[model samples]
Target: MNSIRFTKWLFSTLLFISVAVSSCQKDDNVKSMDSNKSIAAADSASTMGVINTPGNFLAGKGTLKITIEDSTYTFDAATDSVAFINVHSGDSKYFGITAINKAHTMSFGISSVGFAATNVNSKVAGSQFLFKLDEKNPVVQYTLTKYGGKDDSGKISIEKYNNDNLIAKGTFFTFLAKDDKVNSPFYRVEGSFELQLK
Candidate 1:
């Protein structure tokens, strides 16, 4: 009787071990397959001209293109609150505009900054405002010819918003004019940008 009991207990233990081992192997296989799929998707995006990057901005018109060195958002260190994106040059010239919108659906707060339209004839919606600045007198300003955002305020429209890739692309017909505050208004600006603000 004792011997029979020992055999039964050993058989049950072996069965449990086999089941656990098989499950582990299957899990590893699934993980490997998922990882491979991710790599393949990445390769396809680059090869197919899918532009997705944290540093992506392009807008121009005619022969002139706004010289954009970088784009960044600032936050107040003390309050941990949103500040602004600096599109300014070293000069104090007004090359950028700043405003706020708390209900920006772009996941970009302030659903596009409010454009007073005194500077632009059309409606405005962007994370940041673009313009030109006078390097010398530091009192000149320019509006946008081409702009980008995840809204419908601008003349341009959002062609695609890839949720899977977190990319927002659009077109715009920007018309940069100098505000009355400056010595004179700048030329009409126009262009398009396909920024991947992931």
Candidate 2:
């Protein structure tokens, strides 16, 4: 009878030990799941960074126009004909200006006119990607290459003053792009604009 009691007590102790170990395993699993959830939340929050808003600007469409003078023409070996030398100013309606990293990107079109030819109704769509502007002077340089010709580039210097009650503005610049067969037969163009933001 003493041996039988000892055996029963031993069996009971073993069952209690098993139950304790299982409980500890379940608690560890719960803690692991909670830790994983916290890590996921922290990663999601860190991925969203700060975003800055740009200031309001005017629509430059139909707000400015440019005209060229002293365009020259020549013959080309590629076309095998006297292809009239010309420059196409893109349509202003499709032009755009945007601010990027303290600088401005001025993308616009030029109307190309053939030298010594009747006025044509077609204008080429061209763009300049990067234009550097100083916050103080805000002078911008525009450059673009002829579709199948040489590189044409120029500069524009703009000055402005901002006050609480009044604002003063000034702009003056010239840009030229030309297609040359031998020495670059091209045209010179200029733009002028005056605006008052109230």
lDDT (0 to 1) per candidate: 0.28, 0.27
lDDT of 2 at 65: 32
Write one digit per residue (lDDT tens) for candidate 1, span 35-116: 5334434554323322222222111111111222333332211111121121212331111112211222111111122221
Residue 116 shift from truth in candidate 2, angstroms: 39
Task: Give stretches of model 2 more than 4 Å off.
Answer: 1-56, 59-63, 70-152, 161-168, 178-182
Clashing pairs in 1: 101-110, 104-111, 145-174, 145-189, 145-190, 176-189, 178-185, 178-186
What stretches of model 1 exceed 4 Å from their correct place? 1-136, 144-154, 181-186
Number of backbone collisions per candidate, in order?
8, 13
Please write out the lDDT profile of model 2 over residues 1-198, one tens digit for every residue: 653353234333322322222222222133444553344334432133101011212211113334445421111111110001122124212111211211112223222222211122223333222233345655343333342334334333224322232122222233433322344434455553222222
The candidate 1 region of ten consecutive residues with least summed lDDT is 56-65
Error of 1 at 158 (Å): 0.9
What TM-score number comes out for model 1?
0.28
- Native-referenced Cα lDDT, model 1: 0.28
